[model samples]
Target: MTRWVGPWLLLTCVFLLMVGNVDPWNVLVGAGVAAALLRWSGRWLMDGRPPGKLGPRRVWGFGVLALAVLADVVRGTWRMMHVILGPSPGAKQGVVEVPLGERTEGGARVSALVASMAPGSVLLDIDWERRVMRFHMVDASRADEFRADMERFYRERQRAVFP
Candidate 1:
């Protein structure tokens, strides 16, 4: 039952988001489709595994993390615009290795998603053995600052949510 809950909730959210409105008929149809998809997919998506406990602290942490990610997205967009409009015709791009504090697969995936969602950064590779993520950044000069920010995010925001 616990194993089913996560998938159902995820699928339901996806369905609702896809439909984009709360019409009763739309919700009914979306639920049906979500259920069908979940049943057909079986446990392949999560391998019958339940997620970590979502206690109050973790939930709060998740909310904060979401807001932080949103802020990063906005900031990154503005920085990209500046880079494009500024005198610098060609910005230096390079890959930097950022060490990970949260080394779990889920944590790594979330970190990758967050990093890549921002305009200036893309995750190039994950060094599992070394517990580092290689990210290609638009401005190589800010690599140290970006690495510090990522570390701070994981330490302050993501540990509770992903641990």
Candidate 2:
């Protein structure tokens, strides 16, 4: 069924990568293992959720989101390096609360991933009821900047892609 394709493909690719081979026998073995795993755990993997709707606009939004995340990664990495290597001795570390704009579970997950992927930030806690996420920053002095940036990301990038 179409529902099985993603897990099967993902497992097959993982098996192939693990074995580092592409021979017919290897492919068959991978497929067999993938099938077994899917049979045993597919429901758990899918968590009873149906597939989300996808269209050209959503696809394009995903691309844009990827670029924006990439840019944030680079910027965060630079900031981290500066904190580690720069003459300024102590970079204050503290947590900052960022309000979540997207109400959907998918949007919240995407926002968490995008925020945590940046080197300078790590998602510490997500208060779903409060619609806020708390993040520990490498430099607490820049908490305002971090909050603003995350808000911008949620507004500009994550909402379109995940909504």
Candidate 3:
């Protein structure tokens, strides 16, 4: 049965939002416009099928990251100054290859974000085929220890938010 349902509902919303005038003439005009749009949509877009449910928690994840990045920026500035000027705390400098997860895109982003935000670590590159993130970290005398620390930090904070 061809009846005015979805398009009229949408047009009602639009007309009410645009102009509070509710009269027969306005209703007729709005219905005409809405029906034209519905016809166009039927031809060009999906045939009135509802879209998939989008994830709502993505914004909250972003909020969590905004705060974390702010803290990291301030702390990193201080740490960088210390590393450059203050007495040596035995900051290690080398390429520490850390094995990554199978989730290529997410794992790479997490590794880069965490490494760049941490005190003295920078993600140099990520090898997708090898599933490893090559990073440059400071203040670690051992590569294994540094990789463990990175993995632990991600599990504690990043995983909680992103995963």
Candidate 4:
């Protein structure tokens, strides 16, 4: 399932995005072309491209993560505005690492984007071996609190999305 669905979806998206056609008819045609090419030719199946076995729970889990990101984005935007308008420079920023699990590529990307967008944080690097993400935050004193918040947030919000 992983092999089939991931690549199939990727093909659909890349083709739809790159074909650069806005009309519905054009998009349908482009999708048809992409599907034909992908299903008939793509030759990596023998060596790699294992099928991804995403189940209902996995899709449901991602929906939760998506909502969390949306809420975080809104909250972060307002917080950033306050920091900018308030009579103070941004707080003392330092990098902090967050331990993560084997989340999907979309999950990883969203996590990075949301972390960067949140009020006082920005993604610095991802330590895959450590299964953690390094983020620069506005305040250093709150590192423990920040880490705790992230850990809690992911535990509650990500289980469904990436499960």
Measured by TM-score, the strongest candidate is 1
Candidate 1 positional error at 77, Å: 0.8
Give the true-structure RMSD of model 4.
Answer: 8.8
Write the residue-wise lDDT of candidate 4 on 65-133 in tens digits: 777877887877776677677777565667888767656544554466567767788777777777788
* TM per prediction: 0.69, 0.69, 0.50, 0.56
Tens digits of lDDT, candidate 2, 11-116: 9989999999999998999999899767744554666754367889888988999999999999999989988887773558888888877547656666876888
Full ranking by TM-score? 1, 2, 4, 3
Candidate 3's residue-wise lDDT over 13-32, tens digit each?
69756877878888878778
> Which residue segments of model 2 deviate by more than 4 Å?
1-45, 48-51, 88-90
Report the poorest 10 consecutive residues by lDDT, candidate 2.
Answer: 42-51
Model 1: per-residue Cα lDDT over 87-137, one tens digit each: 883468889998877557767767877888989898888888898889988
What lDDT does candidate 4 reach at residue 108? 57
lDDT of 3: 0.64
The positional error of residue 38 in candidate 2, measured at the CA in angstroms, is 15
Backbone clash count, each prediction separately: 0, 0, 2, 10
Stretches of candidate 3 off by over 4 Å are: 1-54, 88-91, 117-119, 142-149, 160-163
Instruction: Record all residue pairs in model 4 with backbone atoms less than 3 Å apart, i.e. clashing.
Output: 1-51, 1-52, 2-51, 2-52, 3-50, 3-51, 3-52, 61-160, 61-161, 62-161
The C-alpha stretches of model 1 lying farther than 4 A from their native spots are: 1-44
Best by lDDT: 2
Residue 31 lDDT in candidate 2: 94
The models' CA-based lDDT, in order, is 0.80, 0.81, 0.64, 0.67
